[model samples]
Target: MQHLDDATRTELEAAAFRRLLHHLDEHKEVQNIDLMILADFCRNCLSKWLVAAADERGADLDYDAAREYVYGMPYAEWKAKYQQDATPEQTAAFEARQAEKREQKDA
Candidate 1:
């Protein structure tokens, strides 16, 4: 990063981000709950981060629109096509992980 020019670094970062989005899109079978449980982030997290980034740059970005950008479709369409119901075990694990995170944050 230090060796690269600012423009080149920015371009590379943007390309990497796009590649990550493409990877997530290609792996649609990977559930959000599993991502949250395992990695503490998911597509919705990406959407929220996009919204925040836009706001920081003085751009307007609502939740659904940001979601559409991340999903490569309308949120509802993406959900219908790729989302699946989480199993009870997945739900429990996710809840437990979230609780642990909250506890760590509060400490």
Candidate 2:
């Protein structure tokens, strides 16, 4: 395995995070629910993680502000522009996926 210095690793991680945000911004058609169902995380999760990180560093950060940073705009505006209502099939599939995950965890 290639070893990286702490600073180098942190810089690379930040760059990757920026790329991920850019990719998500470009793919607005990818619904949050789909992300939650598939990856068990969504933009909201990223925003929450951001807040948690800031808190760990003793920096004050509001969830709404973090959400805006993650979403590249106010979340409400983004939702109005790109979000679609989930279909019944999507909800059912998401529920089934969650149950499967739960069973796997229990086993």
TM-scores, one per candidate: 0.93, 0.93
**How much is 1 displaced in model 1, in angstroms?**
1.8
lDDT string, candidate 1, 50-97, tens digits: 999999999999989989988999999999888889999999999999
Error of 1 at 11 (Å): 0.7
Candidate 2 lDDT over 1-102, as tens digits, reads 159988899899999999999999999999999998889999999999999999999999999999999999999999999999999988998999899999
- By summed lDDT, the worst window of 10 consecutive residues in model 2 runs over 1-10
Error in Å for residue 62 of model 2: 1.1
Number of colliding residue pairs in each model: 0, 0
| Candidate no. 1 TM-score | 0.93
Clashing residue pairs in candidate 2 are none
Candidate 2 residue runs with Cα over 4 Å from true position: none
